[model samples]
Target: MKFSVFQLSRRGARARNEDRIGYCYTREACLLVLADGMGGHAAGDVAAQIALNSVCALFQARATPLLDDAPGFLAEALLHAHRQILRHAQQHHLADAPRTTLVVALLQQGQAWWIHCGDSRLYLARAGALLARTRDHSFRAMAERSGQPPASVNRNLLFTCLGSPSLPISDQAGPWPLARGDRLLLCSDGLWDALGETELLALLAHDPVSLCVPRLVDRALQHTGASSDNVSAIALEWEMPGAQSAPDSISTDALEGDAFESTLQLDAPDLPEPAPPVPALPEDELSEAAIERTIAEINAAIRRPGERRR
Candidate 1:
């Protein structure tokens, strides 16, 4: 597969950036991920970093060339990442677990698959039109879609996220066929919250991802100036031929069967190193009874009241 990809992040007015973004590819598959750490919790950046590390590590191990089950892999990977965040909180004895919104897209064999938790998003555009976009997990978003009154709903408050006490709820989509020039963007809410859909579609539809990503990020930062959130985005244009390529083009045709390439990074010196990759669960460990029990636990947790509604 051949594509052009680019990613960008800005700290904006925040003291530190809590958003993270990256992509990795094997000979037959590519993984794109973005996480927006919830500022309401401590170590938000650490949570975002852990999410990226956990998922990419698992992808590296499982995608020897390509995933056996892309959608299944995404589901298991999200739960694994959630567990890792909880483990981090336990290890550090934090008052509350760090939380983050996560979005991931997997491209392989001429199709795309994605999964997301919380407000981070993935947008698929084709020929100057918005083909699809992930729905946010916030109460305001839910209200808008369900035709419920949204009075007093906080736009930033999400109902679920990784690292919360309850199991996170996530949405999965795809197996969508990719046509040449299809563009997929995975981004933190920071970028989308500041820019309208029309603006994003226009930018993504006309330019190479490398140029589009920078312009999109810059516009977001400028729009929210002085109080902008940590803006981050990662995008790709499907199957752009080498002849028409911009500097960011990548072709996986030459990679060996075992080769892997990634841009995920862990650079903060203060944060502890990420834990080892989560191994796939044994059949017995994932028995039907155990699954039901876990669901019951999550239901109980969700029903319980909190200091403030997420």
Candidate 2:
């Protein structure tokens, strides 16, 4: 399989960039990761950097050799990072425990495996349609699944995450067989919460990550009024010169278009008034609950089964 990878990070309207770190590496296969740090000042940044560094370092040192068990290897790496983050938080007397959201993707032999925690996301797209996405570990998600109006759930509650000693760590990894022309996106909540999958597909269809990354971040900043949070995104595209067309291509396009138009229509009724741009929250004001709520909604949307309808 032939593949291309790209990543981008930006401090959007924030006094300090809290967005931590991201990485993409291709050896016998490809691995991509995105981590969004949570904490005050440089603490969040430190946590995120450490998480990514630790995971990548472990994968290189111990996991790469076990390519046949990439899913298990990646899961173990994530758990290792979680423990390391907790250790660092304790070592330093940070006012807030340093924590982060992590998303990882491993693609090998026309198959992919991924694991995630918190609100960070992993999206798989083929022929302009999202094939699968990871669910967020947040209270809002749990409530909605148990039959609550998603809109009624408070957005600021996380049921699980990294860095919290009490948060349950999940090593559940999703494995899917891939084909040529498949794309994988890993992003922080700062980006995915602002740009829905429809918009994401449209953007990716237009260009590779080198262009899509900045465009997505720009849209988020523009729509959110340049919120101070750091935004990071990593995209991987798999293309084979003569691979067969994806079976879901046609239906996926229809579904993607319908979803896009619906969102546009919903936003349209409230448009034309030239509403003021929403400002990005201050680092101190960042509400994990609100981000978690958005993530819950996304998880639900991805889980719903139907033809891509416009």
Candidate 3:
């Protein structure tokens, strides 16, 4: 099993790029991470770097060739990142804690598994169709699922995130089978919010991720212009056995150094939030009764009004 990767990050009108992305691998396993930082400039970048560093440590601690439990490892690593953020803030005595939205993907034994907190997302496309994508942990996203979104809601208002008082709400999935021509794309809202899913799918459907990734990023920026928000993207393609991949390493420093401009940053609410919303279950994908029950559960998860997504 072999895969290819293409990733890039731009500052996007901000003083510094807060989005961080990296991938590390041994012969049998590989880890992919994308983090979009919130809070202040320096703080947000710090939080994102901490998360990536935390993952690097976890990856090193586990068997490089293979992990015993990929899912469990992902869970612990994310929690570790969350704790690191908290620990950093307390130790430094900062007024506002740095927060972040994180998405991590682990690939092993021809399978994919991932976890996400906040809007940073992982999308899997197989044979030109969307296999799965992580949902955002935002108020607008919840209201949309419940079929009663407010007339005017800020879609970017994230209710859960790393460094918040409450544990960040995370969604996990997969062990999705991999096939030739499968494309896995992970990005921050700066990229996704600027471009719709349909556009993403269409762009990712092309060949040689090296070519596809830049095209995708360029396309995402076409509409946003100077206001583009730290745009970052990583794309991967699984090819036949013995497919060659170069030894590559990505770090937060590279992300911050890249030159792309847009005024975008992560923002989280300080007020107490309702319950954690259940992911919107699709009625077309499931039975009517099941969808109803899921909605009931989601409503129960929330205690008050929520934000919206664009």
TM-score of each: 0.84, 0.71, 0.77
Q: Name the 10 consecutive residues with the lowest summed lDDT in model 1.
A: 269-278
lDDT of 2 by residue, 51-156 (tens): 6756654544442323558877777778777777776677877655677777778766667888888778888888888788887777787777788778877654
Residue 234 in candidate 1 has what lDDT? Answer: 89
lDDT of 1 by residue, 283-307 (tens): 3454434433433333343334433
Ordering by lDDT:
1, 3, 2
Q: How many backbone clashes does candidate 1 have?
A: 1
For residue 304, model 1's alpha carbon misses the true position, in angstroms, by 45
Can you give the lDDT of residue 24 in candidate 3?
A: 59
Please report the candidate that would top lDDT against the real structure. Answer: 1
Error of 2 at 264 (Å): 35
Query: Between 1 and 2, whose TM-score is larger?
Result: 1
Residues 211-282, model 3: lDDT tens digits: 777787777777788877888887878765554443431211222211111111122222213323233333
- The list of candidate 2 runs beyond 4 A from truth reads 24-26, 39-42, 63-66, 93-96, 241-310
lDDT of 2: 0.60
lDDT of 1 at 30: 94
Worst 10 residues of 2 by lDDT: 260-269
